[model samples]
Each structure stands twice: as structure tokens, then as C-alpha cells.
Target: MTYTHASPEHGAPERADDVDDVARILQPDGTRVSDPALDRWISDLPPHELRALHRDMVLTRRLDTEGVALQRQGQLALWAPCRGQEAVQVATAHALAAGDLVFPSYREHGVLLARGARPADFVLAWRGEEHSAYDHAALGVAPVQIIIGAQALHATGWAMGAQRDRSTDVAVAYFGDGATSQGDVNEAMVFASSFRAPVVFVCSNNQWAISEPVTVQARHPIAGRAPGFGIPSMRVDGNDALACLAAMRWALDHARRGEGPAFIEAVTYRLGPHTTSDDPTRYRDADEVERWSRRDPLARLEAYLRDAGVLDDSGLAEVARAADAFAAEVRAACIGAVTRDPASVFDHVYAEPHAPLERQRAEYVDYLDGFSR
Candidate 1:
């Protein structure tokens, strides 16, 4: 099987690089900033919608934490954490309509959760039960593509087909900083730009490609790379929920209007190891972690909510209780998940039976029967 890691993807070299300012919609203090257009966008949202965004962020973070804990405890063989990057996933997901499909990297639990995927189903893949517990067609999401940067190609192709179908549906590809270095990503951007495909590429630049620093991949910000490919791009504070949501809205609109692909680089930090398999202490320093903690999206949004009268102490408590309960249910489901049947391995491989597969299955069954249960 192919190894998958958490990340968020890139193309064009014929055009001049026009990347400059990264748009910001929410200040660190929760105050609105940046373009008046973005300000108006947020103003148009109901207060309840704003609160729901915060709620999604909090719960998604909780799910990330739970997944990490389960992995550490040996409940999961491995896991890719989305801990510090909740706002990037959650806020962007909130901006998508039900019909808009997402081609996500392996670490998009926040996006799936915001799209109403069951918490238990989210953990099923990491638990090694099956490839995916969630249905792709039903959820308007593809299976979390484990091959780095492959989803970009898938999204671009999907967008091309959607355009032909005269469908309003948009396709999104989410990957990490490292994926920008991959050729598949660059090629995907080229196709999307050439076809004017309704695709949006989101790069969650958490500053680490596994253990390597993102600085090693590019000296300039990742967003800057998109302009060279003839794609308009935006960079935003990934930890800022409002900024993430606003940027996504801007990109979605541009793409839906058949303006072609848009790229967003959400600058943030991954507060945890790249995966449960990684030892971050060997690479990242404690000071760096602490620095990111101060900018924790959850805390920033919470402070904003309290000051803006969107949430009070009681409201916060309710969010906490709900998240905790949901997390527990996820844990229980993981623990109680049925073990994969060895015989079932032959299933889902092909739509039809073949001689080789049948022979292999027969041999496997015979071998199994020879053993004492």
C-alpha cells in the first residue's frame, strides 16, 4: 500500500510572478481588516453562522486530538494529525456548498467533519479496517487520496468534467506545503489554468513537510509560486478562521464564474508531529511550538466571539461538552470496530472475477483451512 501523509498542492512558468500581498480578513484580535469587499462578506453573514464556524473549529480540533490519542494508545496503527490547522480546513469547508466536491489529501478530517461525516467513520481508515468508511458519492468527497499531490490532478479532471456537464459544482484540492514541490501538483495547475476548470487549490502551509522545514522547499511564500503558472492566488493567515473562510469564498466565486483555478496558501504551523510516527522534538524546538500556540485559531476565535457577543461562558461550556461527547463516541466506535476478515481481502479489488484472483483466493482458503483455528 502507498504511504500517505498530511499536506495541502501547485503550476505555470511562462508568466511573470505577480504574488505580493496575502489577503487577511480577520485580525489576530478578532477585528476585521483587509479589503472592504471581504469585510462586507463577513458582515452579510448572520451572527449564528459566525458562531457555527467557531463551533466547527472547536469540534474538529477535538477530533484531531482524539485521533492522536488513539494512535498513541495503539488503537490506530498510524494517524495524520490536523491539530493546529483546524481553521484552514473548517473555515474553508464551511464556505463550500453541498454540491461542491472536495478531493482532499489524507489529513482532511476537519473538512470531512464540517461536511457532516460521522466521527467514527473518520477514524475507520486510520484504524486499518478498510480504505474508507465514508461513501464518496454520498458525501460529495473523494476518498482521501494518499498519494501526495495526486488529488490536484483528480480535482482538475473533475472540474473539467463538471464544466462539460454544465454543472455548478466546483472541485477543491487540499494538500500541504511539501506537495507544492511535487510535479503532479504543478501539472494539475497547468491543466486547470489551460481549461479554465472550476477548481480551487488550497495549500495549508503548516511549515513542515514531515520533518523538513518548508523554507527548504521555497524561499518565497507558497502563494507566490502560483502566479508564475498564470493562476491568481491569495495567501491568508490559516489560523484566522474568518480569513480562511473569506479567502475560500473569494476563490470559489472566481472559479464558479468560469474564471479558472484559484490558489490559496494559508500560512500556519503544525503544532504536533507530522504523524504519530514522527519525533518532532528532534527537528522542531519547543519555542517554535509555543509561538504557534499563542496564535491558536481556537483561542483567537474564542476571544473574538466573547468580545463580539457571539458567545458567552455558557455557550463555550456547551461547545466543550458537545465536543467531548462526540470525541468519546468516536473513540468507542474505533475500539469496537470489527476486525478485517482475511478472506474479505479479495473483495473490492475488481468489479469482475478473474482466473488469477480466483486461483489465489482458492489457494488462500485452502491454506486457511489447513490451520487450526
Candidate 2:
């Protein structure tokens, strides 16, 4: 029932050929490892908070499962599973302050869940009902960006604005390893470096990007790319919840103290396909998936908590019941969802009405009237 995760020994170089150049604080078998450098960030976390972390991961997995099911059952257009990246998403979100902002790629369901996204918020866009169901300013999370790596620039720009106003808020961008290869991601790093903006670039280096493996994107560690941009970066075992929490805390502290942006390459695996539209069997080996499954983020954290006396059999059952209830709520919300008026698509295309846009809207209305005739 415990995990035996591979934790790198100390003194490994940051830029290396393999993922061994990573930091970890928990072993796969539920044993706690020591990392003097990173321990301070999470040393004071109370038992209740630790238990909460476990619950968050559990709920996130359930949400992911329900989302995939919804898509399969025809309630959603598509879904992106976070089967193995729960620890990274939940831990990083917990590290954020109320004023901090999140700019996430479309797959960051756990992050949005941790940030209090409602079930309807999660399904609105996937159901083709709205641009984004959640309120961006209110949640402090920007609308999901389907365009790969674009959120990096958005986060950097938001950070720059915060800097100009002398606000203490920081912004974090979440993207996959494939996004690191995109021009927008590279350009965002350049601007963030030049301006010393208070932003954190978090790359969940889930080994595959659609049909391509991580090897196709970078010969070296993704963490290595940030230092060249004059930013400090770290690679952490993404399956280790404690390690991820510690790493994010350190990065957030660095940004909050007026230092330049930092980067985190959370070495994780994509246990599922890239999205509901993808098929891993086409390019991924079954044995490889089996290997990564042994390092399941939820199981790893559950083992750790059980050993630490923070969770028992009853506690585990309670968490499961909560997850089931949450999933059911999400399902009901999606099933009962209502679509918006077709004309509403043009409502927010511009901040104010324009003559040409109004004309286009009128034309569209006339086109719709043709159906009646």
C-alpha cells in the first residue's frame, strides 16, 4: 500500500541528462527523507494541514476521473486528466497567497480545484456553454488558456503590472514540458528576466506531450533552461507532495522578496493520454505506464500520511466519501447545465460596441431568422 518513490541523493547537479537531478523529501514507501535546504518551508505545517493536503489530492483525482467520464458520456467536448500530477498542482496552489495570481494552461484542473473552482466552473467551457465559467478577478485565476505556453506571457505581463503599481502580488504560470519548446514561452522568459518581474514559471514536466515524449522537447533537463535566462530554477520529484509544497514555497518567497522570477520543473509522468482526444497506446509503452503508476502521487501522499499518524482507515474512508459526493455534484451540475444564447458569443468580443461588430451581429441574427423561413 506504500510507495517506494525514487528520491535523488544530495549533491546532484542541477543540469543533467536524467531526472535524477531532482530534489525530494518523501520516499515511495512512505518514509520521510531529509532535505535541510528545503525543509524550512514545510517544517511548520501542522498535522491538520498535512491531512488537508491529502484530501485535496484525493478530491483532485476524483474530479479528474469525473471529468473524463463526463467527456466519455457526452457531457463535455473534452477533458484533460491530471492522473499523476495531483501533488504538483495541489501543493503549488497551497503555496500561493490570497493576492497571488494564477495563469494556467488548460490541463491544470487540480490547480483550479485547489483555488476553489466550482464544479460548474470546471464544466462550463468543456460543455461549450461559456468562454470560462469562473470569475477571473475573483478567483485570482485567469481563464484557461488552450493555446500552449501563452499563459507564460500573460503571467509575466500581469507580474509587470503589479510591479509598476508596487503591489506585493506575484503571478505563477503553469504549463507542460512541450510548452517549453514554444516561442511564446521563450519570449516570456526573456521579458520576465529583463524586467525582474515577480512571476514563477512552473513546468509540470509530465514525460509526454500528446504523442511525443519529453525527450523530443529537451535533451537536457527543463530546469536547466531557466538559468540561462537569468532565473533560478529547481527540479523536484513531482510525485512527492511534501517536496512539491516545499519547492513552491521557496520559489514564492523568492518572488515576494523582490527577486527575479524563478522556475520549477516538476518531474512527473502523464499516466493518461494528453487529453480525452489523445490515445497513449499509439506512442507510449504499457510497461512505461505501469512503472509510473507505482509512483502515483495520491498513493504516495496517502502512504506518508498514514505512517505519520495523520490518517487512518476511517480517515481514508471519509476522504473517499467526500470525493464521491464531490464527483456526484460535478456530474449533476454538468448534466443540468444550460447553454447561452447564440448571439451572446459576440457580447464580449469587444469591451465596447463597435459599428462594424454591431453590423456583423445584425447579419448573424438575420441568418438565424432564415431558419424560421
lDDT of each: 0.85, 0.88
Give candidate 2 misplaced runs (Cα > 4 Å).
1-17
lDDT of 1 by residue, 1-373 (tens): 0101111222322111112244566666666566654564466777899889998888988888999999999999888998889999999999998899999998888899888888777888888888788988878889998899999999999999999999888999999999999999999999999999999999998888998888777866777778777888877788888888888888898898988899988888889888899999999899989978887888888888888888999999999999999899999999999987777889978999899999999999889988976
Could you tell me which 10 consecutive residues in candidate 2 have the lowest summed lDDT?
1-10
TM-scores of the candidates in the order shown: 0.92, 0.95
Regions more than 4 Å wrong, model 1: 1-21, 369-373
Model 2 C-alpha RMSD vs. true structure (Å) is 3.9
Worst 10 residues of 1 by lDDT: 1-10
Error of 1 at 338 (Å): 1.1
lDDT (Cα, 0-100) at 212 in candidate 2: 82
